[model samples]
Target: MKRMSLASLAVAGGILAAQAAAETAAADDIFACYKTAPAAEPDWTAIARDYGHKRLKQGCGQQWPVAATPHPQRASAAAAALAVKTTPRPAPVSDFIWFVRKDFADVDMFGKPQSNEKATGAELSWARNNTAADTIWQVNGLVGLAYSYLNEDYSRFIGASLASYVKVDKEAHSAAASDDSRDAITVGGSAEVGFINPIGGADYVRGSWLETRDGILNRTTGQAKLEWMPMYLRVNRQIPGTFVTTNFRPDLKVQYDERQGGVVPIGFSGFGRSLRIGPEATFLFRVADFGTTLPAWAEPLAGLSGAVTYHWWREVYSGQSGSWLDSTIKYDINPNVALAFSYQKGRNEETAKRTDLYKLSLNFKTCAAFAGFSGGRCTADKD
Candidate 1:
């Protein structure tokens, strides 16, 4: 009985060992299949069918333990990224501007004026974006027309000008409140052609005129000018308990003007170069929010502002020297209309003589009051 029991036990143990070996071999086959699989989505069902492996077919039916399924959020985000890459952006708008200004002098319209200096005038200008390469600088082009009714000599002047300007540098700002805004350096050149007609067609009236003025015989005149602004500073301060704002801008301008004649020294007979260096400063105070807390009667003063400007220039020409001092005070009723009073004591550019004048005028502009007239953005200066 003991011998028979031992034989049965040996047979049972052998069968168990065989089953273990078979399971290990199936696991090895599954691992080998995974190693040869493609990187992209692999068809495991087709791979198992081709290999004719029963273990691989059973493994394919179950979830993969080594490979993870992509998250839905990640897949959606990738799709959005692709869409953005394929989209197109809009283009920028072009600028085309037109501006007009008219100045009416305070004169007795019913009677003849005491002097021709007090006259009405109009100026028209057109500016467009320049296509010059602006990799480092900004460029602009402008054309202007001006008409003056009468000057001191009872003459009318009609002029046309073409100018080009370049902004070589950008404004820089400091962190401190005192040194806030610094304007860019600008350089410009202009060419002007003018026609001067004398009301009294006499040789004596023309003989007393300056060299720069055109006589009746020589009705056509030309001038070329170059301007440079190296320094411009602006400061703004707010009033304590009101909606008032104060602004100050101090600037310097250096300019050279060349007329039709050639260069001639002061003591010498002929013509010479003309140049002027000037410094101008402006101070302005305005109620920024007039309509907010004020009554209806004060609505007209909402955009009201006042400015005072002082100009001092030294002229150097033909070895001769002269200086000019001028001051002007302007009050704006609104954006478009203004009243100005000016006291000028200087060597007059038109008459080329020393003169003192007090003038009052009304100024009108189209760009600020009717923006749509320009068909584009309204800027203080063309750019």
Candidate 2:
């Protein structure tokens, strides 16, 4: 009986040791599954497959591990970091704008031209403006210097302009030549009041008073003259799909020429006292739009552009009239350089002379702003 009891006790002890060893192996397998789990969210199915289902269920209390509650400060910081990584910074803008242009032309016409045989002109313009938000109350002051050489004669001009408008849409145009034939330095100024796009379209209406030291029509030494435009209208239009634009300007002009000594017709006759009514029209055609429709060999012609301008005026009282027609074709080699050919035919009202000329030229333009800002080349009316 004693021997039988000892053997049973040993068997009982062995069964207890086997049970202890199985529990220890199960615990180790659960720990290994947890170490290999995904960081974002644990995959219970994968854990159950790698480790035994019975052990996984026992280790996790028959369910997946509960997600940890996020702390408020930690969550907020994480959101901010994500926003910083995803957001884009704004671009820099400039406060002031400036422009400069230079033109060197060979104006020797096919027929011996009467004016502007060989001409070179340059202009520098600068302006200061308030912010674009304060449109109506903000006034812009513009100053310009110009020099021109024509037919062995040279002229210099310096002018300041003050313009107040409802809204500023585009830059004002400037010419590099004086009105009259005189080798002198002239100083002048102009004041303008206008509104841009008063209705809806790209149109403007302005009244201007321009005074010059030596008038273009009559060169009176050291005498100041005035020209007033009571009504000036500019109309602009664009054609769809064709890349064409048109601008038409019509105005009523009255001038006090020292040569005429009174408010006289300024277009053809400088002596008659009359108001002049005129219209100037310009049409621009951009040929580059056609390149896609043409063969690849004809791609070089895509950089060409053409412009046509017509100006006509009539004296109300004296019935004197004059007209000018100009056509130009330009080829742009690059942004800063261009080659152009132009033909001009005009009847001079003051000198009663007729002019017909052909011009071929090279043009260069550049710009600089107050800040370290860069933009396209400056553009101006070419003569």
Candidate 3:
């Protein structure tokens, strides 16, 4: 963590830039006209233009070190030297941002799928890359509230998380998940190593692990994943650089109850353990760009993603195998709002924990992203 400097505090208070400009003005008041060359060939118009200098005195007042090049252009030697001393740049837009989102799904919200689930989420985040020390880092804090009712199976969960990501080196997307706070109240973190390429889109195998416990569940769980994008595969003739990403994820879900350890279909017991391993493959292609327009209730399908994962499960309650073929179509409704449709087919214990469900859900998002990653169309960078 970097300590807060006085200049930073002034900047936060919206006074640093004004103060610097005042200082520069004071310095320019002392410019020497005697050392300046006449207003002949070496006019020094570029320096005066950029520095808001309309008169020769402003250019002469430039607080730059005089160069020893005893040549014809002595008029702008000081200006030339001072140009290297650039004024502090304005902070990037929304180094810290706050956003709110609401989602409605026909099926369960990752819980049970028969009933509709209504959820709302909010987040405050900050990301800085190529910092004063030329470093990459991101921090985010978010909370989500969800509710669903299925024949007295009324469920309500508030999941809050805080995490920080930092780049360890200058490799492509080499940032690591340095700190993690999982599911409201987990006093732990995760470590990950990854590498990515602009053209290949992260083709290296990277591993990561995290363990978390919260008061809502009163239990602990550990999750790990190793992801790799082998290469691109042409799904159709026109699609370019279609990526094929593969990964394996392992999960350990355990709870404790006084009664005999046996798993039920719907929920977890006090002292029960379930272990699952999942292998997944996904194909994705970017079909469109930003500012895409769509009709009423229709979204511009910007990117296409389809994934299949098979889960092998072993538990005290039931030992079985389940799988899901999920497909998601991303759409850019506008710069502020985006819509998506996702379908999943799985009865894995690690997921819905119900019988197989033919589920489809639509997500609406209104957001602005200031930093690096390009997750959706509602981005501030416009790149």
Candidate 4:
């Protein structure tokens, strides 16, 4: 993507021009006043005319002079006013919500004969400006129930999450990689706070308590994460002819957890931990004069980062354990609504103890009305 510095420079130059125009207008007014006198003052009229002539000469920077009028030349004055009006005004920005639905499939290793099952889930979150008033905000959340058809019985599970971000500076901007370039990369980093539930266990915890006597039983609790991931930071920096426009980044993550509830035996204690390192890839498209020309089935989308994740947790209870591997894809359904799909594979021992799992899902969204704001209007489908 083209850097935003070009646009920023344009705005800055306009501001400078407006300042200069205001100064010139003030000088013009002073010269006009000193040269003009009230018409009713008959005695002063002659003197006023001569004085006006002198001031006009000085003001116009010329030798021969003509009496200056009380008002400056209408044309010049109007031009100055117009310059101010044409100057660019700052655009207003706001926080928003990003939501998604998920599904996954996988195999169970603990079962005598591995069985397969399907699961579904949803995520919802809200973002807001974090600067003094409102300049930055982000969100991540999910709440979905998954069921499995195994052993002629039904098994279910739910997952949820939340995340947020804050703008650390008055003037901060982001850029993306160009599609025409290769072997060139950009680097940027951001800090985020996130949490997750349904700690990947089915029957390890008898109820919801962890008991040491029962040999490391399973338990459910809150998990918190502070992560720094790869982002689209640079673009268009190459030696000569080459297809290289890459955004590269490494991440550091810290986590903490507290456990309670579920079928886990008593005496279980939760622990927090941290992780670091590794680079990831992100989505980058050569920007077009009119955005992009995507596949008929694909809508232009916004991407924040690229990181692969693997999660696993097990409880000592019967049929209460799970593990997951997820690959994420996000695309814009249009300008206001975006869709995210995560390919997931995992194992769950919800009922029959050790069963394969699989899931697939699509998310949908629409604009809504809020205080003092005109909600986005519905238009023809862009996707």
TM-score of each: 0.39, 0.41, 0.32, 0.31
| The 10-residue segment with the lowest total lDDT in model 2 | 105-114
lDDT of model 3 at position 175: 40
Tell me the whole-model lDDT of each prediction, alpha carbons only. 0.34, 0.34, 0.30, 0.26
lDDT of 2 by residue, 88-111 (tens): 533322222233222111111101
lDDT by residue for model 1 (1-383), tens:
01112223234334333333333332322223444443444343343232221112223332332323222322222222222223353333322333332211111110111011111112111222235311122111112221112222212322233323222212222223322122222233333333332221111010011123223122222333332221123466778976667766565545454444333332111244456566656565665553357667655655555445454566665444554444445556555555656555655333233446454655444432122333323332110
Ranking by lDDT: 2, 1, 3, 4
Better of 2 and 4 by lDDT: 2
lDDT of 4 by residue, 1-383 (tens): 11223233344344444444455444433223333343322222332232222111123232222223312332233233334334453333322222122211111100110110011223232223345333221122221111111221111211111212111101121222211111111111112221111222122101011111111133333333343332223222322432222222223333233334346422212222112122222222221122345444333322211113354544333323344345544444443333445543552111111222221223333323234333222111111
196-256 in candidate 3: lDDT tens per residue? 3323322223333333333223444444433342323223233343232222222222221
Clashing pairs in model 3, backbone N/Cα/C closer than 3 A: 108-113, 255-270, 255-271, 256-270, 256-271, 257-270, 257-271
**lDDT score for residue 330 of model 1:** 53
Task: Give the local distance difference test score of model 4.
Answer: 0.26
Model 2 ranges off by over 4 Å = 1-96, 100-199, 207-218, 221-267, 270-274, 289-295, 347-353, 370-383
